[model samples]
Target: MDAFGDGNFEQSEIDPAAEFLAREQNALAGLEDEIPPLPTGPVDDDVTQPKAEDGNDDFSGYTVPKQVTEEPERIRKWREEQKTRLEEKDREEERKKEELREQARKELEDWYKHHEEAISKTKAANRESAKNAEKQFVAETDEIEPGTEWERIAKLCDFNPKTNKSSKDISRMRSIILQLKQNPISTNKKV
Candidate 1:
């Protein structure tokens, strides 16, 4: 029928340009149909009134209350109360610190007392051990005779064997022999 070879092109009576123009006219007419007119009345004063103390706090009416300040006496009283509260808090902290210091002092005293007792016990034990050692030394030296090692040690320690009797000689000889044993090199050189 035409260059595209479509048979409906010849039979159809639809004009695309005319159809598009008709749809545009219909849409434009719908947009203009029955638009509401703009308001023309005076605004009511009640809607713009400020809030009253009667509890109607809607945003349609907003009001700012006056700024109020306390009296000088009331402010002074409040400051005093705040100071008292702070002082009480400080006193409480100080009391706790004092209690801690007292506890620490008591603990230190206990430790010192225990240490003193331990030192006293140790000194007593050491004295007992020394006495036992001296007795044992005397007992050991009691068996020595004229030409023995104890006699030689006694002579070396500036003690005369002739003048010293058995009871006195034994203790003196034991001390001298102990000294000689402690310093063997010096005693050996002397001998």
Candidate 2:
């Protein structure tokens, strides 16, 4: 416990470092109060003005004379004539393009009408060829051979030949399941 004014501490004491810091802070405040005040000067804008000789008023170069309007009128008339000619040329080009487009459309329609039978004949020929290819493929590979593939599968999976009874061939899914179960994992997995 500590007293506020002219009192003594009974239980707790102020730390020496804390007391020294408090005294140092008070001493710094006293020093600051004793220092002289700083002087102030005027701002820069009050002492400076822009000069005309520095080229700020450069409108004198762009000031148009009385005769300037006359020459521009002549140039404007000339440009108007040129613009008219260009517009006429554009209309002519558009008309020519329209005629050419019509001619191309007529030619395409005539060609389609004239060669319609030929197009149908070619498509039918292609369809017939595809059907023949499919028939040849079916004839060649309709039955599985009894040698290598059948023999290996017979040895591995179902091998009861004396009674003449065995399970059907393994399906695609069954083959994948067997391969996954038999092949070891770890580094044996395909890279």
Candidate 3:
């Protein structure tokens, strides 16, 4: 070696570089010893949250799932009440109609039994007999009067309003008289 005097680099010069590499490798190994080891198998996932036992809660006071409700029971009860009310109303209407019908039937029966004897009287439909009329209906009990009760009652009960002539109109007076003569009830009776 031209030693330090001349420009020659020998094995000794390269030895320091090798020593530096070895020291660095040892330091790295030491650092690795202090580090945690890598897992070789699947990590455990058995973590579980405990349920509230003593009923005590954490910071947010343990929010539970919200509950839902239905009002079908209430609605069903309301419907039942409404149905009962409606049924009662219908019954009342029927009772009123029945009362009116009975009164009419009694009046007719009395009239027929007394005046229209021997003949089985029948009913006819007439516009005059409509319950909604603004005027009081009157008729001759003994004679066949125009717009009278006997004729009106006969036509009112026996005739079909859909086809019969109007009682107020005079043109149908002949048909009304003829109709009374042809009536089975009047024909059957002596009067």
Candidate 2 per-residue lDDT, tens place, 49-168, comes to 323597776433232223323458879899999999999999999999999999999999999987997899999999999999789757756654533343334334533334433754
Question: What lDDT does the true structure give each of the candidates?
Answer: 0.70, 0.64, 0.60
TM of each candidate vs. truth: 0.36, 0.28, 0.23
RMSD of each: 20.0, 29.9, 23.6
Decide which is better by lDDT, 1 or 3: 1
The candidate that wins on TM-score is: 1
Runs in model 2 lying further than 4 Å from the true structure: 1-68, 72-76, 121-191
Residue 95 miss distance in model 1 (angstroms): 1.1
Candidate 1: TM-score?
0.36
**Deviation from native of the Cα of residue 27 in model 2, angstroms:** 78
Task: Write the residue-wise lDDT of candidate 1 on 99-182 in tens digits.
Answer: 999999999999999999999999999999999978987886897653466444555464455664644546655675777655
- Residues 1-191 of candidate 3 have per-residue lDDT tens digits of 55578675444645787999999998798787686654434433442333557765442322233345677998989999999999999999999999999999999999878765534232223343454343433333345554444555555454444555655545465566657656534333564
Ranking by lDDT: 1, 2, 3
Local error of candidate 3 at residue 84 (angstroms): 0.5
The superposed Cα distance between candidate 1 and the true structure at residue 114, in angstroms, equals 0.4
